[model samples]
Target chain A: MSDHHEDLPPFCHPVSTKLLFGVFFGLIGLTILTVATSALGSALGMPPAFAFPLAMVIATMKAFLVCAFFMHMWWDKSFNVLAFLSSLLFVSLFIGMTMIDTGEYQPTIEAFDINNLANVEVSE
Target chain B: MAVADSHNTHDDHHDLYDHGEFIAHHFDSAEQQFDSGKLGIWLFLVTEVLFFSGLFVAYTLYRTNHPEVFEQAHVFLNKYLGGLNTIVLLFSSLTMALGVRAAQLGRNKNCSVYILITMVCATMFLGVKAVEYSHKWDMGILVRSAFDLTYTHPTPTTEIGKSLHISDYLVYLCVVPALLLAGFLVASVISKLVNKATLAKFMMAMTITVSGYFLGVVIGIIFMNATEGETGSTHASVIVEQPLMLMASTQDDHAADGDHEDGDHDHDKAAAGSSHDGEHADHEEHFGSHPADGGEASFDAHHPDPSTLSRDVGIFFSIYYCMTGLHAIHIIAGIIALAWVYWRCLLGHWRTDYFGPVDYVGLYWHLVDLIWIYLFPLLYLID
Candidate 1:
């Protein structure tokens, strides 16, 4: 033991309890908001399809709060953040490509796969 | 900590601060080890994101193809239960983050408390999922082929909870955990009798946390019943509540639909032909009369969409089970990880510079929460 006991370095930064509580309550509020807006949208006779994008947007915001504060990406190394964010980039790429591919085959699908309750095959 | 330091071999070099007892020999400094671990965990998280993306892609594909299916199928999912789970996961994420913070400050006891809270939430999540899955199975809501949307829990043929019914599966799933919970309670009391205070406390924490599963089961059943009142888990009830289920159905489309099948399995539709309303005995006579009907005249005004009324509606359930099932798997994996971290915390392994396990596991727990964030909205809240 040395004459003076130097503290261990803060490699993992300790976030304040106050800030943590703030972020947590913020998340709860956002969740309530998302559900409320969805219920409101349906009540107003707005197309239910529009609710999808709205819910996605709210979820993205919640995700941002979670990643930035809860996951500690805000104070983390830029490279680590880059690595995590890149996966999302690739996910969007994959889904986007599939959408494009499915779009190309829409005409062919429409030719045969009409909404017929009678011929609906048991796909289990 | 003293026992751990005895195993440490890095004392050969002179350093300003002493590395913790748990620091690996490969790393020169504690900072290097922590940083390396941080980077590795982030990379693993990256892979996790990519792993779940496949299911998301499948979800998007199906949702885009047959939107009406999603609209009809999602009603079967109890939104109240989904919302409860979302809140539970989010709360657990907060406690996990707090635990990491406590570990950073070297407050092992406080950290363990937070870890216990997180574990309780995780178990509760699985319990609620159990209720949802079993209820769906009882309604014959399976994947594409066996997609029978009838809510009929007939007479129990067995003395034991072992039966072909999916609800019986819940009884089976509860067996192991219930036994484990009993074991933990006994061990906790025994440890206290032996004057092992810490061991007693640890076992007590396990006991309480395991019991959270039962708590979740109770809550899920009650909340589900409250929300599903009057209708009582009936697919017909959900379709009836949604007034616009037949909004897209036009008179000409009915005639156009007539040209679909010369003679197919329309009369032989599983749940539609033989369902809760057992009086509709003559399937062929029933369907030969009205092509645009909701199969039964009683169901026509109530059933929302014609396509939704079909058994192919199981496609949505297929995707639903896959996504949420995968997420549940991750939660179970996370509970194991949290248990490891909690064990290390009990050993007082986390120092200011050596708290890698807590942080890494916190990241993982947060990722699980993030996925559920998307899942709840996508699966339950279909407006």
Candidate 2:
């Protein structure tokens, strides 16, 4: 699974400078794309439902490139990769379960906002 | 790639005993020591991810609950500055990865050079963050309980109009870097005079890294001025009073005063314009509008009252600071750790069998970059 160089150490997985710069430029390009997508998406009246997720997906792609290449995960042990992915799984679970209960109190926030707006008009 | 010739230097490459001091006796071989440390770093990263996940959870919850707050407050965040920082961090991550590769090949010179570049990037990141944070604070964008987005400080009544200048904020940010720069110069000179080549070289690298803060400050100010040229120094008071003047002209007072007709016209368009900026750059008739600016950013034209539109924006900034602030702290910590690696690299402590420190630190640095990948889009490019 690893590159076996007689002179090189077992844990060492030296990356090519070309690949490093390639990832760097790729990240910069994706950054510009993201900014453009957000700008163009709203200008074209794309809904948040679509626009937000689209941005997140791009961010995830960039994150993957950083981990797999810059962090040398592609040559890393499987055990380490599993540990990292599981942490993300737990994060998703944590955010998901907490989110389900939030819907119940959402109306209270809307009610307060409406009540406050009424006061502003009356004062003016 | 430059290390492809490392095999030719095999004769000079130190044997395993040279790396013995770095590896603890508990480890049987250099390979075993490296494996244990690598595993340990990955575990630490898992915990770091979970720690940041808590903040991400807060962000998602609030954003879902009150989307309007995010949409309104996010406009105040200058995406240009954020984008610059993102580029800086990504570039740093590249240098850090190269440094690790250099260390693995036992090229201390290349490794130190790369680590130094990474350090400069870290400081530059903080310098930009300082500009962003202080600018928001001056505008009274703060956490809940202290949130007052509408606090428009009267422009400093001086010929210089120095108050709220982005440069003024930058000076505060540059204080430590400037002192460090001076100290480094002095130390470098003294070390060289004392025939301490190693210490002199180390100090020189540090001087260059600190200078990066000054570089960032310059970029930060240039960006701030470009975005809201009307908000710097002398022009600031004009923007502060722009909204009130715009409000008064709505009563159909046009042409009543022929002398003021030209100035009034500019205000009319600025106040009426879709996003609240009408640049009559050619006309400077002591424009009735203090500075046809700062009726404020990307405001909703449909909702005339700013306070109402800014409702719950504090919640958004609160989360913004918490997430980005913690991330900045990590960057600072990374710099501290990089300083150690820089010292060790200069001492030529890393060889093919003992580059664990560089590798571990590079992993940590990449995590910082990873968080910012999510932050730039989520915070600056809010839908």
Candidate 3:
């Protein structure tokens, strides 16, 4: 095995400690950014729809830093990256379909909430 | 075939079988084994994503249908705690990555230290979650029947007596251990009597049986509690009120408006109707206002009656518990995996040529943190 070992490619990819620390701080910074954005968004009168997307964008950035640097997906093989990214594609599909379906009933839901409140008042 | 090609290129080299003990015999070379293992773990992580997508779908569907419910219920979640957990998990992800790097560089001691740090962070994350959960439980905000029971009972404002909380300890220290001891004793006797095993073998069987029993009990308790909040006899009731009363009300309201055929353009009418309902003034106080402009009101002193909001809010809690509870289970699993890797590192099992286990487990840990990255913002920071 030792003789053939020279034929094998190096298994360990040396990621610098500096780079690791950079990613570490980057993640922490982004976390604070996410929280800050939500608080500031609400304070600045950003609608929930806008705030939600803003927060999601920040979170996506954090996820990317962790995945690329901390998880070492950046240096890893393309196939591995492909494998993980595909899951996100499916997740979007799941969310999209559900949202589309739920949108169809939004009017009904709003009306129901209104009627329920009205009924509660009459009973009181 | 690749192995044969390499062999021909290196015909003057020494024996291939002498590579290292960690490399499995079937693999052509260590790189092949490592790449194969890396690919396998990535595939497993893919499955994990699909597994969790189901829950995310539920979250999206419910939030879309009942944005007000999420808006109201999420207020009860402490953003401070959620943020703290996010940082904790992120730090753990860092430590896990560092640990894998240490192992890859053959720095076993540093690797063990990093894994230990990762485990500590996992424990801390769970600790924060426990605080959040217990708070929710005490407030009668759990899922389904538990929420109903607690909502009705409305545990007094006074602190729970010490004795009332001892059941958890009883379950953990006494009940669990006693069950394990009994299992081990039975297994040892059976091994001796039926298999005619030696004393040492019997002891080994006993040990395995006991550990397995302990693990099963722990997992069972976690799963059971996750699905149904502590359903001891103390909280049990034969009465079964409608589980989805609020849901029914919403549906009825919608159906009633549907009959009128102007639901789509009746935003002002809906608002007027809710404002007219004197009983839901508190609800309207929040719901009637634009959430963005109501930022200051988010911290208002008014507390909605738990009973009145139980139906809609209960559904939110159900999703909250299921998502966070399942995430907590993954954290526990990650902790165990890290512990195993830490132990292996101490044993010098991983080195530059073979740190696959550490690498793979680190990937799993990062994924756990990744999920929480999204979870924190969605569940806690829903402005």
Report the number of the highest-TM-score candidate: 1
lDDT of 2 by residue, B1-383 (tens): 12323233234443334335566756655777888999999999999999999999989887875675676567677888898899999999999999999998888889999999999998888877877876777666677535544334334444333643443444565677889999999999999999999999989989988888877776776777686564534224333433322222122232322223234345533334212222322111122222222112213333433223332465677789999999988998998899899999989998777899999999999999999999998999986
Which whole-number lDDT from 0 to 100 does residue A44 have in model 1?
Answer: 94
DockQ of candidates 1 onward, in order?
A: 0.47, 0.44, 0.38
Task: Quote the true-contact fraction of every model.
Answer: 0.71, 0.70, 0.71
lDDT, candidate 2, equals: 0.73
Per-candidate iRMS values, in order, are 6.0, 6.2, 6.4
- In candidate 2, residue B140 scores what lDDT? 63
Candidate-wise lDDT, in order: 0.73, 0.73, 0.64
Which residue pairs of candidate 1 clash? Answer: A123-B145, A124-B144, A124-B145, B245-B304
**Model 3 lDDT, full chain set:** 0.64
Q: List the residue pairs that clash in candidate 3.
A: A1-B17, A1-B18, A1-B19, A2-B18, A2-B19, A112-B253, A112-B254
RMSD of 3: 12.0
- Stretches > 4 Å off in candidate 3: A1-9, A103-124, B1-18, B148-309
Q: Where is model 2 chain B poorest over a 10-residue stretch in terms of lDDT?
A: B281-290
Q: Model 2, residue B116: displacement in angstroms?
A: 0.7
Residue B268, model 1, lDDT: 35
Which of 1 and 2 is the better model by DockQ? 1
